[model samples]
Target: MYKILKKQKWSDTIYSNWIEAPFVAKAAQPGQFIILITNQKGERIPLTIADSNAKEGWVQIVYQVVGASTLELSLMNEGDSLYAFVGPLGIPSEVENFGGKVLIIGGGIGIAPIHPIAKKLKELGNYVVSIIGARTKDLIIMEDKMREASNELHIATDDGTYGQKGFVTNIMDDILKKESEAIKDIWAIGPPIMMKMCTRVANEHNKQIWVSLNSIMVDGTGMCGACRVSVGGKTKFACVDGPEFRGNLVNFDEMMLRQKQYCDQEREALMLLEEKIRRQASNG
Candidate 1:
């Protein structure tokens, strides 16, 4: 059993948990992920390694309650334990200093996964510039953490409730132009659509870009074939080959379509879970 050492509620739908998994923590890197099961009958839940402490034997995972499985996991507290937590899966992002300057972009919960990457890049003596976005001010998270990790940090919001009042791409475009000569690599993590747009921006600037595909991963292994994505017109499994890949080569349209394959079922499961919870509350 992997015990939850700490729990934090970022928002109504988002959460952060620190789990005691010594082996996984020791092997964790900036871009790997873990698959957790709430119980014997629970579905596998794949989440990126947001942060880790090797000495403490704890891995921090940030997740959003999107369906029944996640909602069930969120109900767990600091003292709770997960039935199974298997990880540091997938390839770690290339950590070498590329010249000197690199750009990091994060959208919503994607910010969590990018935090460690930004910190690591900074430690390697690279100038890290990070752009983080959410729908509004209330939705923004980990501002202090990202700022500490980055040499410079920019924020964007869809509703103008904080930072720039536009899509992150707007800021990305301007920054890429400003840093064109110095910036050589970029890392973006978020929704498929967001990453697609970021990739487009990076390509226009002629910079190498990597994006995370953990959202499409299922079963946390190549056996499921569910994380298959087209990269450079070839199939690659996100879990085994990478949860991170060259954004310029990924077929974002197909990946986004695959992400919705089980939406209806996910919605139904959430609805049923809500009904059950309401009944339990009423009975209690």
Candidate 2:
């Protein structure tokens, strides 16, 4: 059993946890993920590695209480033990200089995964510029952390609640226009729609972005066909091949459809869990 060393509730739905998984923490890189099982009855779920400390024997994971398994996980507290924690899986992000500066684009929870990437890139002698966004200011996350990781940090919100009133892409365009010569690599991780849009913008400027497909993963292994994605007209599994890929070569339209394939089933599972919790509370 993997022990939960610490847990912090970021909001009503989002939580950050540090689990005692020394091996996984030692092997984890910027873009790799972990598969977590809440209990024997719980389904497997993939979560990005938000942070890690190999020497300290801990790996951090930031997750939102989005579905049934996550709701179940949220009920647990610090010092609780997890049924299973398998990882430092998937390909790590390329953390080279890229001959110049690089751009890091993270949206909502995407910022969690991007935080380590930003820190790594900066450590590797690359000037890191990051832009993070959410629907509104209250939804913005990791502002202080990203700021520390990046040489320059920018924020955007759909509403004018925080940094910029427009989307992150707006600032992306402005930066690329001004420093197209210095910026050679881009990493964008977020909701599918946001990634698709960022990819489109990058392509227009004759550039490509690396995007993480963590949202589509199920088994966190090639055995599950659920995470199949088309990249450069070839079949690829997001788990074994990558949770990160060249955004320009990916077929986001098909990916978007595949993401919704199990919505009804997932909704049903969540409802059942909620009802069960209610019954337990009433019984108590």
Candidate 3:
């Protein structure tokens, strides 16, 4: 059983947990994820490792409480134990000194997965510029960490409650217009729609863009075809092939549709669970 050592609420729907998992922490790399099960009957969920410390035997995971499994996870507190926490799974981000400016764009919880990538890029002596966005200022997270990892940081909010009153793509466009020559590559992670727009902007400017795809994953071991995505007109499994791919070549429209395949059922489940919980509380 993995124990939760710390917990922090980043926003109304986002949370971070520091869990005791020495082996996973020691082996984890940027872009790798883990499969966690809350209880014996709980469904496995894959979560990116936001940060880790091998020596301390701890790994941090940032998650959004979107589905029933994640909602249950959000309810877990410090000292709570998990039934299963298996991995440093999937391939790590390819970090190298590309020897030019790198721009990292992350939206909402996507910023969590980008944290380690940004840190590694900085360590490789690359000048990193980070752009993070959320629906509003209150929903923005890890601003201080991103700032420290990046040579320059930009923030955007859909509601204009933060640094720039626009989407992260707007910031990307501004950077492309002003610092086109300095930019070598762009890494983006966020909602499919956001990543799609970023890729479109980058491609229009002839900029190299990489995106992390987070489709609905179950086994997370590549055994399940649930996380399969089309890239460059070919089929690729997100679990084994990549959670990251060339943004311009990915079929974002199809991916977005596949991601919501179970939304109706998921919503129904959540509603039932909430009702049951409320009724139980009243009965008690």
Q: Rate the local accuracy (lDDT) of all candidates.
A: 0.91, 0.90, 0.92
Q: Name model 3 segments beyond 4 Å from true.
A: none
Q: After TM-score superposition, what is the CA distance of residue 186 in candidate 3 from its true location, in Å? A: 1.0
Estimate TM-scores for all models.
0.98, 0.97, 0.98
lDDT of 3: 0.92
| Clash number by candidate, in order | 0, 0, 0
Q: In candidate 2, what residue range of length 10 has the lowest lDDT sum? A: 214-223
Name the better of 1 and 3 by lDDT. 3
State how far residue 263 of model 2 sits from its true place (Å).
0.7
Candidate 3 C-alpha lDDT tens digits along 1-284 = 59999999988899999999999999999988888999888888888888999999999999999988899899888999999998888889988998989999999999999999999999999999999999999889999999989999999999998899989999999999998989988899988899999999998899879899988888898898999899999999988888888998999999999999999999987898788889999999
What RMSD does model 2 have?
A: 1.2
Q: Which stretches of candidate 1 lie over 4 Å from their true place?
A: none
Q: Which candidate is the best by lDDT?
A: 3
Who is ahead in TM-score, 2 or 3?
3
* Candidate 1 TM-score, C-alpha based: 0.98
**If the candidates were sorted by their lDDT against the true structure, best first, what order would they fall in?**
3, 1, 2
